[model samples]
Structure formats: structure tokens, C-alpha cells
Target: MQNTRIILIGAGIGGLTAGLALQRRGFKVSVYEQAAQLGEVGAGLTLSPNATHALEAIGLGPDLAKLASRPARQAVLHYRTGDVLVDQERGDLPKKQYGADYYQIHRADLHDMLARAVQANDPTAIHLGHTFLGLTQNSDTVDVVFKNGARVTGDVVIGCDGIKSEVRAQLWGRVPPRFTGNIAWRGLVPMYRLPPGFKIEPASAAAVGHKHSMARYLIRNGTMLNYVAFAEKSGWETESWSVRSEVSELLEEFDDWHPSFKTFLAATPKDLCFKWAIHDRDPLPQWTKGRVSLLGDAAHPMLPFLGMGAATGIEDAVVLARAFQQAKSVAEALLRYENARRERTTFIQMASRAAQERLQGGKADGYTKKEHKNEEFLGLFSYNPATVAV
Candidate 1:
């Protein structure tokens, strides 16, 4: 297994994590990305205990602590009245309960961290500007072709490509991801730009309304506030994160929201506001076929309600590395990874949709802690992918 050459399609979080994990385990890994330059979008992501534990296993605990923020509290608020509907402690609570700390970090920071670590292991591990076209696999090896007229063969091919994965398309025709009728607008506000006496109590908060919701959290060492507003709409189907929108339009959409939310929106930089359509895919019946397999969004694209999309992908990367270490052959390793991950990823996929319904389907005033189904309430944080049965 030490001599096995692993090929990864896409250099997103999952792909980078997988590359780093495999390199740490003494496996030769290569990552191909479609972009000309390597960078993640300007966005914030929550790292639950499961994801933190997995990163810790790969020796990133200290680095993560430096770049991520630990929110002391979280809350659900009524959109109109700004009343806190439910509040929960998050700082030391997650560490005590799950044996790992929960974090909120900028997506680009985490991506850069993983990419740097992977490159440190092998300076030539990642190959950019190589758009994946397709692959042909046999009983012994898998040959991957790129649009740049580059062809590489490896013992295993892992499709970490995103929802519009060309690898997945080659394996099982082009199945379009279903847009969940939800459009989201995201923006970041510098902490200094807010009005005087503005409080960001309960460091992370979500304001729920009728058919609309907004979540805000501190990131980048509490110097920037990241917020995403969701609304069920139709006729707009673009899913690109770089699509910019007017701050005026954003304020118009939530004019009736609580004063605090409106204040945050007003302070957002015009260029920082981006709008995108949220899309998800049905769980695949299987993830592995012979020596090629799928990982992260390629296998199971998730809704953002539960904030587990990145976490699950990170978990997949860790378990995949573990599977390779325990299996005697490439085929067995792929099969083991598929079997160990299917159940958990599938559940999160379905549960995230359910969470969306709960957050947007009803009145915000009706929300209760007893009926809430978030990552914490669903026992997702308890999963220790580093030590789970892989």
C-alpha cells in the first residue's frame, strides 16, 4: 500500500484533506484541480467536533486553533422581534462532550492550511490547471485524462470533484443536481463597520422567519462577521459562488427583518455580497466501482442547513486514509471506505433537508429547542471519524 499511487480529482477541501492524509500515511498522492489558481471562496464554515477530531488526527490541531474562532454561544432568534428563541453554549461545551473543540473559520484559511501541509509533504503533490475530462479503469489501475492533454495512471482514483463532477458523470451519466428552491445571499462585514452599541452576543445566531432565514457568525479572529440569508424563490438557478448582487437588493429583501439584521446588511461591503442557488443530490446507491470511487460532494452533496457539508467531507478524507492503511489491496480499500461512509453521509444528506424545512417551513415564533434537529441534537458531533470503525 505504501507504493500505491493515488489520484484525486479536484483540489477542494476534501481533496486537499485526502491528499494530506494519504501523504502522512506514506502513500504517493497527486491532486488535479480545474482552476488556474488555488483558492477557496470568501466564506465561513463551521467545524463541528467530528471535523476537528479528524483534522487533529492528521496533526492540524494547533494550526486550526490559530486560524479558527471558537464561538462561546449560539442562538436561534425571531426574525421580526429579534427575541432569542433558543440559546445554547458552544465554547467549552463541545470540548467537554465530544473530546474536540468546535470552530468557525474562513474557508480560504482552512483550504490554505491543508494545501500548505500537503505540499510540505511533497512539493509536487498538487497539479493545478488540469481540468479532469474522464477516466478509464481496469482491474489493476485507473488512467485519468485531463483537458490539457495530460494523462496519468494510478492505483486508485478518488473523485473529490464537486456537484457537477465530470468523474461522476463518466461513471454514471450526467444527473443534474436538484435545486432546493432556495436562493442564498452571503456577505461579510468588518467588525468595526457596525453601528455603535451593536452587540454580537451568542457569537453565532440564526434569525428564522416565514420562508426566510439568516445565519450570522464571527470568523477570522472575530474581525469579520459572515452572514448568509436564505429565501425560497424560483426562476433563478445560477449556483456559482462568485455571482455578485447589489446590497440594495439585499436590504430590500429583508427590509422587515429585525433591526440588527438590517444593520448588518447595511454595513456589508457592496462587492462582498454574492448570491447563489442551493442545490443538493440524492445519495448514491454505491460510491466505489472497482478501483475508482467517489468522495465528499461527488458521493453525497448536502444542504447547508446542518453546517455539516465540509465536516462530512473532511471525515470522508480521514476514513479513506484509514481504510487504505488497513486493507491489503486497492479494491478492498475502496470498498471499505464506501461501506463505512454510506450510512453516515446518507443520513446527513436527508437530515439537512429536514433541517431546512424546519428552519424555513414554519413561523420563527414557533421554534423550540425540544423540536430542533441540528448537528448537536442529532448526535453528529459525537462521531469521532479518527477513531470510528473504518
Candidate 2:
């Protein structure tokens, strides 16, 4: 493995996780990111047992626990009435049942932790501002050219560059992702901002209504409430996270909901909000082309309704590392990685789409069943990438 030099494109969760895992496996890894700096701004993510196990395998469990909040339970609520539709215990129950706990953490905190781990393994491994331009490879090695006119070479290139991946576009040509007709407004509010009489339970609560939904959960050790409200629309022309949204617009979208839900939105300290239209691609029949392969959103992007998007990416990193551990050659390892991961990711992709439909069609109960079913959640949560055969 020491002779293997791996190049990872993207500095997000998937890329950083893969860098750490590959470094631990004794491979030389260099992570290149298009961003000027490594940071996750104004977003949140849920890490189920499967992701927790993967992070623990890479020795970041203790750090993650400190940076994240564990919800006592996850409940689906009536969007207009705030009534509980379904409840699934989390916290110790998930840890007891699946050997790892479910956690919600600010995206920045998790990304920072992963960056720290990668730096500890190799201080100079991360390169910022290296936008991927294109790549060319021979039978034995690959050369990647960046936008800055810098070129880097490696044994294999892993595309964790995300949904609009340059590597995917360069490899498979530009095929645009289809918009799911849903736009989401995301905001973070300090817990102290809530009115004194307001009593919000410590749980991951999803308020579901006709063609709209809002999920509120705690992050940053319960000091901040991460809110994501979704509404169905004809289309959103811009698919970006930097788009500013007015608070009034957000309020108008959910005006008919429960007063308590509205209260949560009103409690926001400022008018700042970020919104993005959800877009996903049909699963590609293949995730690999020659020595280059894709991971995370680059490989498969899905709706956020199921909260498995990042978790699946984390799973990809671990399984990819496992594939390398067992296979004799780079090509063999990548093939094994895809063979082991494609089915699971595809299943989650379809399930999340189904869940999105159920949520918008006034049948969130169906999505809840999909979430609560032992076979569905367990089959996903209980997967141990460290030991799973690749």
C-alpha cells in the first residue's frame, strides 16, 4: 500500500473520509478541493449507526460524540397540527441495537474533525484551491490537471467531487441532473432565541404536511436548532447553496402550518437563510471508468428526505478502503468497491425518492414505516464496512 499514491478530488465528507482511511491503510493520499479553504458553512447532517461505525473505525468516534448531539428519539409530526404521527427511539437504543448511536451534527464540525484526522495522518496531504480541470492516464498511472495550471499525478483518482462533479462530467460528458421540484429553506437558530414559554423536545422532529415538510433537530451540542423546511414548486432555476432567501418568503411557504411550527421560524434571530433546489441523477450503470472511480454524490445523489445522503457517502469511503485492503491491484480493488456498494446505494437512492413522494402526497405514514421497519433501517444501520466483504 505504501507504493500506492491515491488522488482524491473534493474535500467534503467523502473525500476526507477516504483520505483518512487510505492513509491508515498505509497509502499515500493527496486530497484536492476547489474551495479556497476547507469548511462547511450553514448546514447540518445526520449520521446513523452505519456512518458512526465508519468514523469509529477511523478513530474519530470520541471527537464526533463531543461535537454532535444525540436525539432521544425521532418523531414524525403532523405538519398543520404538530401531532405525533410516529416515533422511533434513538440515542442509546440505536447504539444498543446497532452497536453505534445516531447523531446529528453541524456539517462544519464533522468536516473539521475529518480534516483534523487527515492532517494528523499526513500534514501536507490536503491541497486547497486546486480545482480539477481534467485528467489523463496510462496503463500504470494517472495525471490530473487543475485549473491553476498545476498538475498532480497518482496511481488512481477517486472522484468525491460531489453531484456536479467535474470528473464525472469529464468522464461521462455533461448530463444534467433532474430537479425533484422541491426547494428547501435552511436556517440555524440558537436555542436561547426561542421564547421562554416555548418547550421543544430534544428529538429529531419531522413535521409533514401536504406537499411540504419541515425537519428540526439539534446540532452543535444542542445549542443550535437546525431547521430545514421544504416546499414543492414547479421548478427552481438556480441550484445553489449561496442563494439568499427572505424570511417572509419562507414564512409564506409554511403559513398554514401549526402555530408552534411558525413560532420556531419566527424565533430565528435574523433574516438570513440559504435555499437550494433538490436535484438527483438516475443511478449510473457503472461508477468506474478505467483507474478513475466515483464516490458519494458523484456516484449517486439522492433526496434529503431520508437523511441518508451523507451516511451513504461515509459508507462509500469505508467500503472503498476495504476493497483496497482485500484486492491485489488498484483495478481489482475499485471493481470490488463498486460491486459491494452499488446495490446498497441504489436501494437507498430509490427508497429516499419513495420517501419524498410519500411526504409530499400526504402519506408520511408510509415513509415512517419505511424508516421504522427493522429490516429496512437495520439492514442499512447494521452494515459494518470494516468487516463487510468487498
Candidate 3:
């Protein structure tokens, strides 16, 4: 493994996390991100216990607590009329029962934390403005082709790239991510603008309701709440992140909803909210092909339901790092990493899809929050990466 190098494509939460994890494992890692800067768009991200375990392994757990919240109570579900469905206490339950605290933070905050960690830990390891185009692998080495027509050789390549990964296309052929028939509109609102009573309810700054199976949460230390608006159709003319998200479009969706919900939407700048097409890919037969493999959204893209996307990717970084820490050879480590993750990540992907359906209400399963006893939720959050992975 002399001069072993890990070329990670896509410097997202996964890619940069991989860089940090791999570096700690004694590998020279370089992360290539297409964006000119290392960052994420507006939105909220929930870090379940399991994911926090992974972050903790990378020394980010306590630091994250500063910019995020561990809700003293669990999620409370309500009907559109504000009738309480379930008021389950989540504080002692998830932490004591599951092992890790359920955390919610702004996507940008978490991104910034990880980005800074990568730079501090391994300076110049994450290079922005470089896009992955394809990859070529031999038995001993892999060469990553970038959009800029540059080729970097490494011991192996990991497609921590996102849903639209070029290396994934070259390895498994072009399998376009399928639209989940749902579009999520996300926005951020200042905490002061919210009604005082809008303290702890879904659809309000108080709660990230699951009625539409949409996700919303307060980030930036509760000074603001992130809103995610979702629907079960794709009437949108196009699907691109760069397209301007209109505020009126977001207003129309919650027109008849509660005043608290309305006020948050109104508070948003006309261009603040973003339209994101919920896209996902079928589980691949294998993530490793010779000396290159897939990671995160490139290997498994998912919807926002169950709030595990970022967590899962972070887990991938830890697992990948640990597998290499254990395996005898680099290629064998890739296979081991793929074996450890493919099935678990696949389950998460399908679980996210199912959650989307439950949130949409197009197909009702159980309305009572007590009945929604998330057996998987506890299992999903209770990952202790330090002991578990090693």
C-alpha cells in the first residue's frame, strides 16, 4: 500500500467526510468537488443518533452541538386542524433507549463544520471547482477523469459524488435517477417573525410536521426555522438546482393551512425557497468495480424522509475508513466496505421512499403517533461507530 491514495469525487458531506476519515486511517486522500466553493444550499438536516455516532468518530459530535439542537421532546404529529395526534417525549427515550441523541441542524452549518475539519485535518485535500467526468481502473490503480480534462491517479477512486455521478455512469452505465413523483420546496425564516404560540408544532417553527411527509426544523440555534414543502407530483417544467425558487409557488401549497405556516412562508424572500426534485436510484448490484467504488448518493441517493441522508453518508465515510483500517489490501478493503454498506444503505433508501409515501398521505398507513412506533427509527439512530465499526 505504498503511496496509497484515495481520490474522492464530490466534496459533499460524504466526500469531505471521507477525506477526513481516510486521512486519519493513514491514507493520502484528495476530494474533488464541482462547486467553486465548499458548501451546501439552504435547508435543515437531521442527524439521528447513529449518524451522530459516525460524526463522533470523526470528532465532530460535541462541536456540532453548538450550532444544532437536541429537541427536549420528540416529534408531535397533528392533523391539518391542529388536533394533537401524539405527544411522545423524545429526550430520554431516543438517547437512553437508542444510544445517541436525535439532532437537527442547518445543512450549511454542518457542511461548514465538515469543510473546516477537512481543511484543518488535511489541508489542500479538498479541491473545489473540479468536476468528475469518468474513471478508469486497473487491478492496482484507478485514474479519475475530471471535467477539466485532468486525470489523477490513485490507489482507488470513490464516487462520493452525488445523485448525478459521472463515475457511477461509467461503471454501471447511465441509470438516470428516477423521480419519486414528489417535489420538495425548502425555505428559511427568522425565528422572531414567527407567532409566539408557534412554539412546538409541526408546520410551525414549533414543529417539523410530517403530514405532507415533508421535513422542517429549526436551525442556526433556533434563531431560524428551515421549511421543507413537498407534494406528490412533478408539474415543474424542469429540474435543476440553479433555477430560481419562487415564493408564491411555495405560498400556494400551504394556502389553506394554519396561519403559523402562512406567516413563515410570507416571511421568506421571494427567491429564498428552492425547488428540489426528490430523486433516487435503484440499489446497484455492486458498488466496487476493480479499484473504484461508489459512496453516498452516488451509490445510494435518497429522499429526505426519515432524515438519514447526511447521516448515512457520514457513516459511509467512517465505514470506508475502518474497512481500510482492517483489510489486508486496498481492493479487498473496497469489497469489504461495499459488503458492509450495500445492504444497510439499500434498506435506508427504500425506507426513505416508504416514509415519503406516509408523509404524502396519498396512502395512509397509521395516523396515531403511538402506532407509528418507529422500531427502525431507534435502530437507525443507535449506531456507535467507534466500537461498532472497529
lDDT of 1 by residue, 75-120 (tens): 9999998999999998899999999999999999999999999999
* Candidate 2 segments exceeding 4 Å error: 364-378
Across 60-137, the per-residue lDDT of candidate 3 in tens digits comes to: 877876777766655433425444554556555667876666778888888888888888877888887888877767
Among the numbered candidates, top TM-score falls to 1
Ten residues in sequence with the least summed lDDT for candidate 2: 369-378
| TM-score per model over all chains | 0.99, 0.96, 0.92
Residue-level lDDT for 217 in candidate 2: 92
Q: In model 1, which regions exceed 4 Å deviation? A: none
lDDT of 2: 0.85
Q: How many clashing residue pairs, candidate 3? A: 7
Local error of candidate 2 at 35, Å? 0.8
Ranking by lDDT: 1, 2, 3
